[model samples]
Target: MNWYRFSDLAIDDDEISMLRRVHIYVCSSKDLEPESAGGTEIGKMLFHLYRQGVRSELGLIRMVTEGEPPPAAEAE
Candidate 1:
């Protein structure tokens, strides 16, 4: 299960550039209890918004995964 909080560009003159940096925070849990399921639900909701093109770039961001080194260290 995962919990996600999504924030995108707000529709207003003041938020034009300020809102472009959409933020999505996801809390992942392996538990199957009701509470954990709730977190998963939240992640799904954020994904739905991404598919619907809600944000400027749909919350795309740089990600680093286990065992994957940084690009600078990658052999050419």
Candidate 2:
């Protein structure tokens, strides 16, 4: 399942900004898993948070850490 670790939630301006610039790369792509089908659960979570509102524009982006280049079909 998709759970948030401390590092996953931390803020690093340089990396964060770089991620926003490439938001489309991650946020636009969707891979439905067994737990949450239909739409991207993470995307839905972010959308919910956006609906709640934030001080600045929050963009969702993803990166490759290990496994496949697209970073899919694995367990964390």
Candidate 3:
């Protein structure tokens, strides 16, 4: 079985720009209206999660695009 990597996709500049925008939006949203109470905390949490997820995805992309892949294991 072959594993798919983000680098395998032919992602265009527009898609990359959109991902960057989403990352920035989530990061900014985490700090927005910190003075507010109630649902503000929940919103921050969600935004934090989003930021983490995006960062993870970006890391994967970087790894696949810029780093050498590990040798694939031989099938049993």
Candidate 4:
């Protein structure tokens, strides 16, 4: 669902789908608590993606929205 757009990196269709699922899980699970489960899970996923070099427009948007820095640029 195209959750984010930044510069030239667009999160792939699959990642968008995953984000939608994450959103749904956060929205529906009252037991989990948004801050604890939802926030942590999403944060972990974002960090993992950043480390794996999966930087994308969607990911960058997520970072900014969540008050995070964009992934580091590759070394020259």
Best by lDDT: 4
Q: Is candidate 2 or candidate 3 better by TM-score?
A: 3
Query: Which stretches of candidate 1 lie above 4 Å from their native place?
Result: 1-35, 56-76
User: 1-76, model 2: which lDDT tens digit per residue?
Assistant: 9787776566578754644433334444444441344435544554444334321342333222123365456686
What does the lDDT come to for candidate 3? 0.47
Q: Distance (Å) between predicted and true CA of 73, model 4?
A: 35
> Which runs in model 2 stand beyond 4 Å of their true positions?
1-23, 28-39, 58-76
Candidate 1 residue lDDT tens string, 1-76: 8554454432455433423232222332222332366555644554456455544432422221224343355566
Q: What digit string (tens of lDDT, one per residue) describes model 4 on residues 48-69?
A: 6654575564554455246544
The ten-residue window of minimal lDDT in model 1 covers 57-66
- Candidate numbers, best lDDT first, in rank order: 4, 3, 2, 1
State which candidate, 1 or 2, has the greater lDDT.
2
Local error of candidate 4 at 35, Å?
Answer: 2.5
Please list all clashing residue pairs in model 1, or write none if there are none. 2-39
lDDT of each: 0.39, 0.43, 0.47, 0.54
Ten contiguous residues minimizing lDDT sum, candidate 3:
59-68
